[model samples]
Target: MIGTAKYLFGLSVGLIALLCFAAGAVIDRRPDVPRAPPPDAQEVRAALGFGQMALILMGTSSPVSFTLPQAWLDGVHSLVSHGKDNLAMDGRIDGRGAVFRVSKRLTRHGWLNLAFRLEETSAGGAPRLILYAGGWRAPEWLTAALLRMGLPLLGGSQELESLIPAFRAEDQTVQMTARVPRALVGGLQAVLGSGEGGGVDLELVRAIYGELLAGAVLEPEPDYARIVRRAAMQVDSAEGLKAALVALTMFTDGPRVLRLAGDRTKTPPCALTAFATRLHGRADTPKHWVLSAALTMFMDEKTGRAIGLWKELDDSLPGGSGFSFVDLAADMAGVRIGKAARDGTDIDKVIAGLRSGRPEIILPSAVLQLPEALPHHQWKRRYGPLEERRMMRQERLIGNLLDRSPLYSRLPPSRP
Candidate 1:
């Protein structure tokens, strides 16, 4: 009986061990590995061409990081060697890296300006690029170009939302900056949590931008004083204040608040009446208290305190580093204040000059220095380098077209 018992026990143990081994093997062979991107390899290769262009415009040292499959880099190389529709300044490959410039026609205005550098995976296992925001004027346009090339910003896609938590680093805050309304509170909370001395909550700032883009009509709570005090506590740092200015000035309607032409098609204005009104004199508020005041004036168009507030802001707010929020606001307000002869000519300047209550028919200036058209064949001879040559050629062509086209003549010239 004892011998029989021992044999049965030993057999049971052996069976259990075999079952464990089989289960381990099945798990090992499971198809659950992380994928790089869009299922089509060919598409990824095609995207490399555009990615290469974005890399040059943004730069190798940019704060924004991107990781692409090695295959994408290989494909970009193939295009550079053969593609004729490529940019005048074709991308150059360096060991495990690439650099290039990209230019695009801005209708009759001018070509889009950009340059960048790209590198293989960093220690974080993704390619990285640096954007000199100081020089980067049209971020939205640049972002669109990158998206066309299959490179979206981090935490930028809805399909990738579930995977976001896994991808986020320990210290990284949840980024909610998209044209989504649900993320506003979460973003606000993050910014407020940063406190007086903490780093600016960039993620939160992005959330605000998302709200603006969606043309959110924020209805303030009954306790206006409490909310305003809370906002003051949340955005105490200079960096935080700057972040607010950036988010606010880059209005959802477009770059500038005012419409260039008098179409009377206005975007539904952001509802800031309550918050701005309440925030007027809250203690320990942002140094640029006028920011809130300005918001109220923008939405209400009262101009009661707006004109005086503008003077104070224009005098106090420092300039000369990057795109100015003051300039953006001024344009939106349609208040032109340059030299007498140089009021309105280029569509951009005209857009800037158009202020609230100003007449729309400002004439083109007499000193209008339109670009000189040069023939394509003489591109290399007249322009010294690749960058200069391409820029000059495009400008000249645009200038000649402007001079000849009836559209240019229809535009009103500067008065007096």
Candidate 2:
């Protein structure tokens, strides 16, 4: 009887251990593990091609890092070499399927642009982005090209690098400014601007780039800002300057841009309203004050003083965001949907009659996302990367939009 009891206890303990392991498998969901992008293995090999040039390239920024283990280094080196070996500046990535020649249309912009190299996959297969080299500096010619052809800034200083575990030390906040050749940058710009067919952001990209990326303060240099802002205008083919002017009309007494735009066409008051509302203020609330303001604004904490939250700006504000900062407000011409669903209105069809724009779709898809018991932002600070922080902020912005819109209940909270 004693031996049987001991055996039973041992089995129970083992079962508990297995359950804990299973729970861990469920919870330890990192993006990289599941969303590992397919690399063009052959193209990777070509990118690494360097018969004679290999010796000279060593002294520069070593891709070698202590953080990156040895075996991995050998693998990546193999990949880079594959491209360098078989490929030339003009060679097609997968010559059999579709050749990815650098577009001449992009060349005029100069060197300070991310050279997006296209690699050929199997025949009829989608092209894969294999080479993320070049685009570190802009030459005089490239700058001139931008001026002449109107290619403005796209990537900011903060985004010069990204999360490359193999090349970086411990993964905190380090922008691995790729030390690619200035000429290489210029070459890429030429290819992209050449416009034969390089899939760069040909249109104005209104992405809200954040500064917390490098954990460093970006000195106020209006040159890049001006370039980017103007580029944003150029991409949409709508005058961003004019959009700014149109947005400024919101403050004026008469009907705003949305109101006037909605007058002739089926643009939603909210569609134009979002653009006008974006002009409200550059609402850069600090982290702590955001908490206080939330308690005040939503929780009805009279002392919360969300209005005062704007007053207490900490750390010079890492790119202020508001409820309605539409990076693409200029693009909101007409709605393209048939039936409206938000707050039970035909706003979708109304907007569709006006313009054909893709609507923003939001989803959580995580069980943890549903649980509001723990403060997510706080959790992110404790263990999240800068990207996670930005994601959380974006989630908050989406929530704010829903709360304001008549579409809160219409949005399905949970997805299968």
Candidate 3:
């Protein structure tokens, strides 16, 4: 009787293990990953043009509404996801709310899927977001409990409701309406618009290209300061000048900018191709580093994406030089310069300072004093991502240095 009991017990244990494994297998089915298509130059240009137009329209007091097609959303998703193929998103509007489905592929086999609906509910006569229909491959009670715990940790629904005033999802398109501050609208207009009208001036763009070609022949080195000065000089209006400054940032770091834009065939004539070659050489200068930061900032703004996160990840990995505050300074300086271009508050002073051919005019020499690199562990311990205190201190120091400098002071105030 004892022997028979032991055999039955062993069989029951094995059956339980088998059942657990089968359950995992059911949840972990192979994920179907979609490949991102290559970017088309025409589509990119059109999108930029439309964005610029939308900024101009938003300058008015009235609310602005725009519809984004599924293709554009897919492209944006691919871009934000870094084309990892490990994650995907699908969203649509159902009735008064919107539903978003997100899926992540597991390392070995299955996909972890979560679907949620966002519906606006009235709370004390104000609109607020209520998350509904949220679940994954978990029990209903467990999923609900997890969502309830996670929502507050992710800034609650208040943040989402504030950011998205009105949203409508459809099978093929998503329409959104937003109200932007006048200051932001004015700044965008100053940088993106032509004084004669709302949209960018074709003549100004042609002149910029013309100047680039002319500079290539006239100057042996890719002197960006000279190019920017000359481009700014051609346009009489403040808006035109600001537009030129912002546009010229693309060529400042030509190689990386081209790569980011998916333009492999065409190269700017202003020794951009040669300059790209020189960047990898031993003779590269601090100016090159500063220009690269500026290009990164410009690209970030243009695409509404953050490439710096990728840079930080790459630097933090094994065999890398780690994080560098000097790089941070350069990034801050580049962002300040971009802001100046957009504000156009001191356009004359900016133009005058650029002609001096001194990189210190933009990136202060004080930045060289900062620590070169810190390993991932040290960086995490000392200064983690989005750490408010460290960021505020750094911004204050950089702001003070830029404000004290004659060249940077000529531009608008650096508001962090």
For this target, which candidate reaches the highest TM-score against the unseen true structure?
3
State the lDDT at 9 in candidate 1.
79
How far residue 20's Cα lies from its native spot in candidate 2, in Å, is: 52
Expressed as tens digits, the lDDT of each residue in 117-234 for candidate 3 is: 5554433211233332223233444434443443344434323433356776555655666455443443432332221222334345546755755676677454444455566666
Report the Cα lDDT for residue 17, model 1.
Answer: 46
lDDT score, candidate 3, position 125: 17
Q: On a 0 to 1 TM-score scale, where does candidate 2 land against the true structure?
A: 0.20
Clashing pairs for model 3 are: 28-110, 93-169
True lDDT of residue 31, candidate 3 = 38
Residue 285 miss distance in model 1 (angstroms)? 40
Candidate with best lDDT: 3
Q: TM-score winner between 1 and 3, please give it.
A: 3
Go through the candidates in order and give each one's C-alpha lDDT.
0.31, 0.25, 0.47
lDDT of 2 by residue, 104-189 (tens): 11123322212333233343222233322231233434333332322113222212221111222222211122233322344433
Quality of model 1 by C-alpha lDDT: 0.31
